[model samples]
Target: MKIAIAGGTGLVGRALTALLHEQGHEVITLTRGKPKNARHVQWLNGTLPLEQLEGIEAFVNLAGVSLNDGRWTAEQKEAIYHSRMTATEEMLRIVTQLSTPPQVIVNASAVGIYPISTTATYSETSTQRAQDFLGKTVADWEQKASRAKELGIRTCLARFGVILDTEAGALPLIALPYKLFVGGTIGSGKQWLSWIHVHDVARAILHAIETPSLEGAINFAAPQAERMKSFGKTVGRVLNRPHWLPVPSFALQLALGEKSVLVLGGQHVVPDKLMATGFTFQFPTLDEALHDLYKS
Candidate 1:
């Protein structure tokens, strides 16, 4: 199989790219910068070398700015929105122009599209879309990515949860406080944290590509969703540290502005669509995922 990946340098993209290559698939990275290696192709301002579009079977667009980079100012929010929309639009445009466009298009989305709720459990079929900034961004992003279906291509929107990897994402920051023996829950510690191991994230993407029946919104999350308080205890247990300090809601809000919701708020997202299509998760439990990631 031949795959083209946008934003292959990101946290999730990097892992996905490596996994694809390990599985004997040819991986081509589409980047805005210079092609650093033979497998990399440069695409700028929605422009790409048309010759490279041939024979690509799968197109995965993970191109987007880091949401947790900093506080979500108006400028940063626009950048976040622009980066995702433009990169996805470029890939879709190239796909349309290709003589043999990819059979499947797997896009990166977020569970944040579901409203932040403790009591509500969301699945792919849920019609309730979030009206907040992050929710709207993900909803619009998925809408744009959905255009590939019009061209007779199978499209899968992998709505990611809190990706748990030791190298990057939220794990390190969450574990750092534990290492220092000051780790605890944030806010009321009751908010649901829909999380998945990074390995499962990569696997889920490949599953979506090969599974013909999967052609819509799929939550790439674990089977079990944990509350912040229990999540903290698991981290502490895994690292042999103490979970005994609470970071107040106001503190996070003051520090992260609106972006604090990414941590302070969460959703109980279930992978109903993914599981229905017969995709199994490598790390379905928070304890199993944390132990695997933190094990020496």
Candidate 2:
């Protein structure tokens, strides 16, 4: 199969590309930055030229600014929003214009699409009612991906949780502080964190492509969802570090500004759609994921 990864240089994207390549699939990387190695097709503003949109069997749309890139100011928030929505819209438009569009679009979303407040339980069937900045960001991101349905292509929006990769994402950032024996949970740490291993995540995308029955929204998260405090303790235990001092919510709010929701706020998202479709997870437990990610 020939696949195009929009943000293929990113942490997860890089891993996905290599995995796909190893599996004997043709992988094309669409980037906004400098051309790296071969197999790169630069897409200005994430828009593929009309002539270049043919023959691709699948598209893994992971093009967006990093969510954990520090605090979210007004400008940074707008960039985050536009970066996702605009790129998705461009892909949808390009795919819509194609004579033979890709069979599937595995677009990335976030667990934040579900409201942080668990007044009502959320599943794939749950209606979207996002209030916060990141929530609204994901709301629009999924909205763009849903456009592929109009083109008669399968659109799979994999709303992810905190991706559990070792060097990138939250691991390295938190590892150092923990290694010093001062790492602990942020805020009251009662907020739920529905996370997934990067390997499971990549494999799930491949599943979406191979499985003809998949469409609509699917949560790309493990079955083992835990509170932030428990997550800290689990990671601390996995690394043999003492989970000591806590980072107060006020300090996090001050440091992260509106982006403090990443640490202070999260949702209890379950991979209902993915599971119902018979997707097996390799690292469904926090300990299993952490142990593998922390592998030396």
Candidate 3:
């Protein structure tokens, strides 16, 4: 299979790219700038050379900036929203123009689309929308990605949670405080933390591509969701450190501004749709995930 990936240079993209290559699939990356290598092609202002998308069997769109990278100023928020919307819209445009459109289009989304709650668990069927900036952004993101379905393509919206890995995503930063022996719960500690191992993230995307019936929003999260306090303790145990100190919400809000919700806010999400299709998680529990990530 030939797979074309947009934003194939980011954290999740890199992992997905490597996984596809291991499976003997030819991969081409669509970038915002000039082709960095033989594998990359440039996409300017949502326009691309149509020939590049021809005969592509699968399209995995993970194009977006890190929501946690910096404080979300007015300018930063616009960039975050535009980056996802434009990239996805561009992919749809290219696919419609292709002589042979891909069978599956797996788009990157977030569990943050659901409203934040301490006890409420959310599934794909949930009707209420998140009332914040990130939530609205994801809502629009999914809407744009869903447009591919109108072209008779099986589209899968992967609503990923906190992806845990030793090299990148949220794990390293969350583990750093534990490694230094100052780690503890963030905020009130009861907030839920829905997470998945990076290994499963790649597998889930492949599963969506192979399974024709799998479409719409699929939660790419573990079956077991943990509270912030418990999650902190588990990380501490894995790192052989003490979970004693607490990072105040005020401090985080002051430092991260509106972006503090990425940590202080919480969501209890599950991979019901993914599991319904018999997709098994590599790290179903926090203990299993943390141990695998921190093992020396």
| Top model number, lDDT | 1
Report lDDT (Cα) of residue 108, candidate 2.
91
lDDT-based ranking, best first? 1, 3, 2
Which regions in candidate 1 have their CA more than 4 angstroms from the true location? none
Least accurate stretch of 10 residues (summed lDDT) in model 3? 44-53
| lDDT value, candidate 3, whole model | 0.89
| C-alpha local distance difference test of each model | 0.91, 0.83, 0.89
Compose the digit string of candidate 3's lDDT tens values, residues 56-146.
8999999998886778999999999998987888888888888888999999999999999997999999887898999999999999899
Candidate 3 at residue 244, lDDT? Answer: 96
Candidate 1: clashing pairs of residues: none
> What TM-score goes with each of the models?
0.98, 0.94, 0.97
Q: Could you give candidate 2's per-residue lDDT for residues 112-181 as a string of tens digits? A: 8888863445688888677878777788788878978888888898888888787788767667778888
Q: Which stretches of candidate 2 lie over 4 Å from their true place?
A: 45-47, 50-53, 118-121
Stronger candidate by TM-score (2 vs 3):
3
Range of the 10 consecutive residues with the lowest summed lDDT in candidate 1: 44-53
Candidate 3: clashing pairs of residues: none
- Model 1 per-residue lDDT tens digits across residues 177-272: 999999998889999999999989999999999998998899999999999999999999999998899999999899889998988899999899
